[model samples]
Target chain A: MILHHLYILGITVEAITGALKAGTKKMDVFGVIIIACATAIGGGNIRDVLLGNHPISWVGHPEYIVITTCAALITILLSPFMKYFHRVFLVLDALGLVTFTIIGVRMTLALGHGFIVASIMGVITGVSGGVIRDVLCRDIPLVFQKEVYAGVSIVSAWLFLILHAQGLPEISVILITLGTGFSLRLLAIYYNLEVPKFNYTQMD
Target chain B: MILHHLYILGITVEAITGALKAGTKKMDVFGVIIIACATAIGGGNIRDVLLGNHPISWVGHPEYIVITTCAALITILLSPFMKYFHRVFLVLDALGLVTFTIIGVRMTLALGHGFIVASIMGVITGVSGGVIRDVLCRDIPLVFQKEVYAGVSIVSAWLFLILHAQGLPEISVILITLGTGFSLRLLAIYYNLEVPKFNYTQMD
Candidate 1:
């Protein structure tokens, strides 16, 4: 439960970073907070609605809003140190990817979905927030490109499921999943790994 | 049934527009096609998923993809007519809004949800495609802004419900709802009608 709260906090941080980097405009406090909140919890909101969970996660827990608001404020105040923003964004994104993937898989599994569905949910939850953020910013989503971004989350989800099946402890499964996702993402970024392009030429 | 097919066709056209606008340097043909498809059917997709309809509207109908692909090809070929793009976008957007609002309300009614839920669903459906388009483009959703945008759909939905309750014929209800939304949206755009902004000074 404490870890869950930490995970949410990490998401708020990520949202702040994403909101700051998304546009060239100097967004006012309200706009910053709104973008941060949308980036942090937008995916979960969509996921909950799709799963028929009423009241939605953010509606039920307004603390998420408070946290996101605070994070956005802090980021806005510290906007001068924009040079470090990229590094911060990368780290926070990796954290968000791991945490959301775990949460998504757990939620789907709890709802009695199969492994394939749960894995898909993991990827969706992990990347959908960034996708939403990019859309709101009026830019193309990085995921729509050939990035190996979502692939890491998919692999982590499968690893978590496999670990669970092997009778590993819940904490072990989560740690492994998080570690795997973070490492894979970091490596992908370092190596500039990307997915292969679709064979558009073959279509004709 | 004809309306449904028209709605699908409008989505295809909108998707193609989005693809052409998305730019070839930033995204390949496949990426453009995917973004366009998402923009076209994204609103209805969210509405159906939220309403807990199985299989999803687009997934259940593969013809949507064929239409979207053909539209993308045409839009790409006709990319030179940049002056007419905005005008085309406005007309297509209006059509999409009216059609999706009706679909949302009708679907909600079919699912036995109350008028309130149905109206909310109508607003959701009407605004969702733009939201998806904004998100795909990485911009703040027009729905979240202080626009007269979604409010028109909400009002039209309630009007449709009230007319239905008054024992109006089905065809009349549909026409009235569509006309109300179409006219209201055009008028709003013409006059630049906007939603009232929340005064921050009034808050504690």
Candidate 2:
């Protein structure tokens, strides 16, 4: 029950960031809304598609569409003051990522998938939205290039599976995974930790 | 019947182009194969996902994956001589686009969707692979910037719907749409025709 509300809050935050990205590109209002919705829902969309899950969640819940659209409009209105809220947004974004990762793992496991698929789904849910947004906005995906963003999701997903296998209560698993994943992401951000990049120059 | 073979040919051509793009970026062989697969199947993937269709075609037919991988390897081997085949590739690509668009429309209509959805799906099927390829390559999608690419798909889709509604034989509908669409795309390339680009400068 609480998780559902958190999911809503997570998507709303993601939508605002997506709208801000569209602002940077000077996209029209329609494009802003489209990008915002994509950023908020694209990760789950990709996951469900890969899993062959039908009737995508948003299709069944148009309220989510309304919510993301509202978030985008509000974001555009507050664009000038957005920089002042940068620190807050980062914290919220970190929380959202962890929340999304947990939800993804739980859902995948519920669908009878195992650890490897679960971990991939969790990371995809955590980062693919931002990747999609960046792609649509014509920027290199930040997750692929830098940070421990996907790494955090992978760890959290594995941790969740391990703890669940130990017969922990569902709530306990969620709380432990959330705390660890959130802290890891924040630390990575604060310390500017980055994964080593694969820069493959041609041998020609 | 013949459509199936055309579909296979279409994806093979798409995969080769994707591999070529990956080569220019100096990606590893694995990256080249992944991009090639995405370029060949990404359009249908997106269309099916959006339509909430399950068991994506490729999942059911691993042969498609094998075909694309083989195409990518062949492309890499032939990369040195590719410039000489540029004209051949362009014509093949045009055929692929029309083939994919027609298949997309027929699939959507078979699923009981109306014209609007069918047209959108057709366009997505025709151009989305290249869009995904360009996005992964960190380039603005050429279809969006400077081509009649998507426009051609849209026209082909609508034409298919209209001709099919006229109670023509299924093969006749397919042939007519294919002829007009293939010719239009070739003319677009030959004349360097382009859609008007959207350039939205922000108002301070």
Write candidate 2's Cα lDDT for A67-151 as tens digits: 9989988887777677778888888888899899999999999999998999899999999999999888898787776668888
Top candidate by DockQ: 1
Stretches of model 2 off by over 4 angstroms after superposition: A195-204, B1-45, B52-130, B133-138, B142-204
lDDT tens string, model 1, A20-64?
Answer: 854355566777777888888887876676566668887988888
Candidate 2 lDDT tens digits, B83-154: 999999989999999999999999988987767667767877998899889889987666654457767787
Supply every candidate's count of residue pairs whose N, Cα or C atoms clash at under 3 angstroms: 15, 0
lDDT winner? 2
What C-alpha lDDT values do all the predictions have?
0.73, 0.86
For each prediction in turn, the share of the native Cα contacts (below 8 Å between chains A and B) that it retains comes to 0.21, 0.13
